[model samples]
Structure formats: C-alpha cells, structure tokens
Target: MNDLHAVNTILADHLRIVLVGTQHPGNIGAAARAMKTMGLSKLVLVAPEKAPDRDTLAMAAGADDLVERASVFASLAEAVADCRWVLGATARNRRIQLEPLHPRDAAQRALVAAAAGPVALVFGRERTGLNNAELQLCHAAVHIPSDPAFSSLNLAAAVQVLSYELRCALLGDAGSAGQSRTPPPTAEVAAHAELEGLFAQLADTLDQIDFHKGRAPDSAMRKLRRLYLRANLDSADVRLLRGVLADTQRMARIAGEASVDKKIR
Candidate 1:
C-alpha cells in the first residue's frame, strides 16, 4: 500500500488531462473532480464552448481548486504542444488503423511515457468526439471497454474510468507490468511542438514538388503523421528528419529555377 501511494504521487506529477473542444462547463468541473480523486491535478481545456460558471463550481464539489487552476488553450495542438506523448480517447475506428488500446493497457503505456516527459490524455468534444485532425495529433487511441448494448459513456464518466485505470497502473498492481525483466533505457521523445514543426516542413516540401498531384493532401499527411508518431522519434530523430525535408525543399526550388532558365535559353 505504501509503495502504491508513493508511486501515485510521483506519477501524478508527470500526467496531464486535456479536454478538447468541451461543450459543457459541468463536464469540466466533473472531470476536475474525477482527476482529483485519482491523484491527478494537471487539467487543460482546449477551446471549450462554455467556460466554467457557477454550475461548474457547484459540480466540482470539493475539487474547485483544480478547476480554478486549470489552463485553457485556443486549440488541441496548443494544449499538448509541450507534451512528449499524446493519447486520444476515442471509441470509433477510423479509416486509418490507429493502434487501439484498452484503458488499462493505455495506462501502462502512458506511465512509461510519463517517466520520460509530460504525457497528455486527451478527451474530445462531448457531442462529436475527436475529429480526424485532432486524432492525428495523438500517438495512439485509448478505448474504455463498455457493454456493447450501451457503450456510450458520458464525458466525465469516460475521464473517471481512464483516470482510475491510470491510478491502478501507478499503484503497481496492473497486470500489464512484467514481473521479472530489466527495463530498457528510456528515450527522450520529441515534444509535440517539434513534431508539429516537422510536419509543417514536410507538407511544404511535398507541395514544392507537387507530390500530392491533385489528390487530397490531408489523407497522405494524416497517414504520415500516424506513421512517424508511432515511431516515437527522439530529439535526434526529429532533427535528422527535418534536415532531410529542408534539403528536399532546397533541391526542388533549384530544379524549378533551372527548368525556367532552360525554357528561356
């Protein structure tokens, strides 16, 4: 019990819960309440449709402090900009095959990431949930197992379930942990902001060469994002990839100019 308590305390510091495009202020308060119960205090809301009000405070019960301290962002990307690992809470399967993890399994993976840097668990809007673009930002998707007859879980309920699993994972009783094995050396994963910059550079380079060729670039970019995110690129990896993209762009521009000169000659 003592070991579990200590683990929970330390893990809490590295975990952050992000609510994206939240529609209800009450859900924010409820989520804060749930987080506090599970030893989590870092809460971020991205572009909430309704800011916290009197009802929100009332719903928070005794966890108003968490609600008060919660930071708000203008977008999902901005919310997780500094986080090294992002997990999206999604129940639906999209066209792209995202690695779907059960809540407990997700918690174990998240704990590993938290050991390296701040990790974010992102919950999408209450109505539509995370869109394709928002989900693309995440490295993986976490789904809470619910009865197929009535699987729809409330936003706050989903947060509570995931938080509970995380708490259990931290407590060292989660079955996902191996009993006897040497843990591998941890990698310093690049922050979301760095990955975002790399993605932008890649898009620009691809455009310069007309790689899309009238096809919708969103599909190709989304696939690329998922592929690289799964690779869990470290700082060195990001730098190397960005350098390649930069050189590609430079070469494309030079080739374009040479073609123009040849036409004139």
Candidate 2:
C-alpha cells in the first residue's frame, strides 16, 4: 500500500460518521457506501426514521458489513458522547454562531482532534438540516461550497464529499517529499458530557445572579456555548470553571439572604 493509503488506514479508525434524524433508509445505505469507499467504517445513526432495512442493505451494495455493524443512538449528544471533537455538516445559515470551515479545512481540524480521541462528522436531517440546539453541540461547522444556482446537495453526496476531503488531507500531495505521518500530540480536551455539565452549572449560576437582565437568554447562552466549545478546554479548565460557578451560586444565595435580613430589620 502507498503512503496515502496508509494514512487513511489510521485516520479511519479515529473518525466516526454520524447521521442525525436520517429519514430515508436508502440514504443510510448510500452513506455507508460513501464512507466505505473512503476507508471509513464507524457509522453512527442518531434516531433514524427507520433502522437499516432491506432498502439500506440493497443501497449499501457491497458495504453491507458497515450497515450491519452501525450503531443506533437516540440523540446527537448520545451519539457523540465519547468524541472530543464534533464537526457539524450544514449548508444553511442559522441564528447560532459557529466557526465555519471549508470541507478541506474541516478535515484538517478533524484530523488534529482525532489525534487525541474520537472525532465525529455530524450530518443533520435531509429536509431541514441540524436544528440550532443541535448545531450548538458541535465544535465547528463544515460547509461544502457549490454553485449558487442550485446549491442543494444530496445527503449521501455531501458525506462523500467530506469523506474525500478528509482522505485528501491525510494523504497530502504525492509530489511532496517525505512528509511527516506521525499523529500530533493529542490535547487533553474535555469531553462533550463534561462541558455540558459545566454549561448546566453556568446557567444555574447565571440565573442566580440575574445575568440575563430582562431579555430572553437562549441566544446569549448559545453564543456562550460556542465561545467555550471553541476554546477546546481541558479537564482542569472545566473543573476550575465549575468550581467558580459553584462559588458564584453560593455568594448569590448569601447576598439574597443578607438583603432579606436588612429588609426585615
């Protein structure tokens, strides 16, 4: 096997392709075919409308093994529970702010994250794409550029495109002489679940301190989530933030009690 093939061989083990709320069973099969063609095997389905059925098997063609081995998840969070990094594949703009990257750049970022642990490439539903809340869970968004006249791409086709980009990123140019193939030093990034716990603590503390003022807080919280996720915080940072939030909660409660005592006096 060539150098490119060797790089893809290792990259495949560290990357996972996740489909969220996939409506068509055929699309699942086609996606599996796409991944298999690109030397990817870990396929995760998040709450598909239908499980891998006869259509999926038929559409998968020779990649039936991937379909059989695919794992089913009830939610996106559950699907990427263990992944240190998640890149959402989205075509449309939404209210939530996310770091957007071209397919190639996203592939590079994914490879770096995969050095540490599992990295997920998430695809949303066929019709509406990922919801705002779902997108917030992702560390970044991968956008595939196409003609402005008709930009809509098939779900499986999108998967194929991203998978190809990832492969290219791993392989490098054939002309380049003796490029390094060793994986970078993996960062000790906190997992999604740990970050989610910190976010919960943050929200409660913010509420205790009236941080939102009079306006609705969802938008602010979404932005904050994006900000912190982009920071790629490690376990130590997460622990420190959570501890600070706990202290903030306690201080706010004490202040409230003191005000009550003053009013009573």
lDDT of each: 0.86, 0.85
Output the number of the TM-score-best candidate: 1
Task: Name the TM-score of candidate 1.
Answer: 0.93
Which pairs in model 2 have colliding backbones? Answer: none
Best by lDDT: 1
- Each model's number of backbone clashes? 0, 0
| lDDT per residue as tens, model 1, 1-265 | 8876676676688799999988889999999999989889999999999999988898898999989999999999998998888889997887655777778778888898787778899999998899988888888788887888999999999999999988888876787743312131155888899999999999999899999999989889988887787777878999999999989999999999999999999
- Which residue pairs in candidate 1 have backbone atoms (N, alpha carbon, C) closer than 3 angstroms, thus clashing? none
- Residues 1-265, model 2: lDDT tens digits: 6975666667678899999999999999999999999878999999998888999989999999998999998999888878898889999788876777778777876877777888999999999999988998888788899998999999999999999887776666322222222222247989888888999898888888999997798987997897788677888999999999998999999999999999999
lDDT of 1: 0.86
TM-score of each: 0.93, 0.91
